[model samples]
Target: MMRITDHPVLGPLENKEVTIQFNGVDYIGLENESIAATLLANGIRTLRYSEKERKPRGIYCGIGHCYECRVTVNGERSVRACITPVKDQMIVESQGFQS
Candidate 1:
């Protein structure tokens, strides 16, 4: 039941879905949806760990302003997943101090 099997407000999430790779692992996501939303929908939390303090962080504002939702996209650093649309074959990786 990783998927949003049933939601009270949304009432069974259904939309155009796509597959994307996260840290080399494939996952099902919705097209045209924000990366953060897709990840959250699929039960992915703790987007990144703080470099200095190693503090866990995830979606806070749900907007693009916050950098907490930042993740590496196709080898690019500090890409905000909250604003980025899910693209097919896109490679996403968790932001961490060490690989």
Candidate 2:
């Protein structure tokens, strides 16, 4: 559960539950949640495979410093999911080398 289920500092994040699309698949998430958080809560890791090495990666730093959580948002490339708020109708896709 992303180890946030009973976090010591953040506690439980507040947000209205919502649905969003990830890679053409609809998934339930919180509106106030970061895209990476939502994906982690839903047991989604490996946000993208590295272009060269093709290594599996998920959220490395929750502060968005690392690009491990980057994903496409509404046709934009390299959107950091660790900081981007989840929004309704947002289109998120895992980026590939050719993308």
Candidate 3:
């Protein structure tokens, strides 16, 4: 997966690195950052899928306003990844067929 190792404007971000499990795969992300940000940093764009049309959905409005960025977190359903911070060992999964 593609990752943002360095940013031109922000340069290299210095934050506490933590491991989070996504779909049973381990990925390292920054602690206290939003789950969506972590996922985007790790090249994860599709967060969930629509129940009706089964369309892929991702971050939109990114501030807890839109529900498109919903994902399952630690067995909890409909969790907003855009606003939820990444925690160490947190299990996150895309809401694939769950409605």
Candidate 4:
């Protein structure tokens, strides 16, 4: 539903469907697309909870400068989703700030 059908400069993006598990929900996204882009495209706004207040946090900087989009990939902690590429059958867990 969130996939871009047409672009002004890039034109229609090719659809190569790939599945990624987020918070135990299976969602479809483009292959090789950044995890942050994929999550945003799928209407996933909150990627993690704040360390102290436990407030919801999502992609603040798309270039990995901000650590808001941190998620656990394949049991690896603190993986930045903004720069990480999506892989088939990847397990993504919404993580909170590590104390």
Candidate 5:
């Protein structure tokens, strides 16, 4: 993702890079960064789809207020990616009926 190398006040981010599995594909992300950020960095903006219209949905509101960024983590469903931290070997799946 577009991580800030040095936050003017917080200094450099030392979070180690970790590999995460999204939709069966491997992607690199910071250990502590949000899953949503990691996916967005990898050009994966469509997190899910609208139930009725079958429209693609991504990050909205960004603070967990909206459930547009929902996804399946490991074996858990309805997990919010915007708030979940990425970890090594974490398996994330896009929530929808498409695949």
Candidate 6:
């Protein structure tokens, strides 16, 4: 959803296919795109859950203004997927409240 295919000024963005893992499953994503954007392009929207309510949260305020898109990246918690670039073979896991 966030990929810039064609812009009036930037024209186009060039990206190559990349491999990334999400929740133990490997998926194909574009290089240099944000983790949240890649996940959204793959139709996976739930990035994390509310700390208390356990409600599914995703790319809300995608510009990094909110924590709704936070997820675990490479065993690190509280990583904001919406702004974090997706690295090839990067590991991403949905974050849920510790219960």
RMSD of each: 4.4, 3.3, 4.4, 4.0, 3.4, 3.5
Better structure of 1 and 6 per TM-score: 6
lDDT of each structure? 0.76, 0.77, 0.82, 0.81, 0.82, 0.80
lDDT by residue (1-99, candidate 3, tens digit) is 444444433345447899999888898888777788898988888888898888889999877888999999999989999878889999999987644
Model 5: per-residue lDDT, tens digit, 1-99? 376444333344457989999988999987767788889889899998878888898999766779899999998998988877788999999877674
How far does residue 10 in candidate 3 sit from its true spot (Å)? 17
Query: Residues 6-70, candidate 4, lDDT per residue (tens digit)?
Result: 43333454578899999899988887777777888989988899888998989897777888889
| Clash pairs (backbone) in predicted model 4 | none
lDDT of 1 at 30: 69
- The digit string of per-residue lDDT tens for model 2 on 1-99 reads 443442333345555777878888888787657888788878787788888887777889778677888899999999998888778778889987523
Provide the TM-score for each candidate, comma-separated. Answer: 0.80, 0.82, 0.82, 0.82, 0.85, 0.84
Query: What is the TM-score (0 to 1) of candidate 4?
Result: 0.82
Clashes of each: 0, 0, 0, 0, 0, 0
For candidate 1, lDDT tens digit of each residue in 2-92? 5443433334544777898887788888666677777887778878888888887888876677789889999999998877777877888
Q: Can you give the lDDT of residue 27 in candidate 6?
A: 81
Better candidate by lDDT, 1 or 4: 4
Worst window of 10 by summed lDDT in candidate 1 = 1-10
Regions of model 1 farther than 4 Å from truth: 1-14, 97-99
Pick out the ten consecutive residues of candidate 4 with the lowest summed lDDT: 4-13
Deviation in angstroms for 12 in model 6? 7.0
For candidate 5, report its TM-score: 0.85
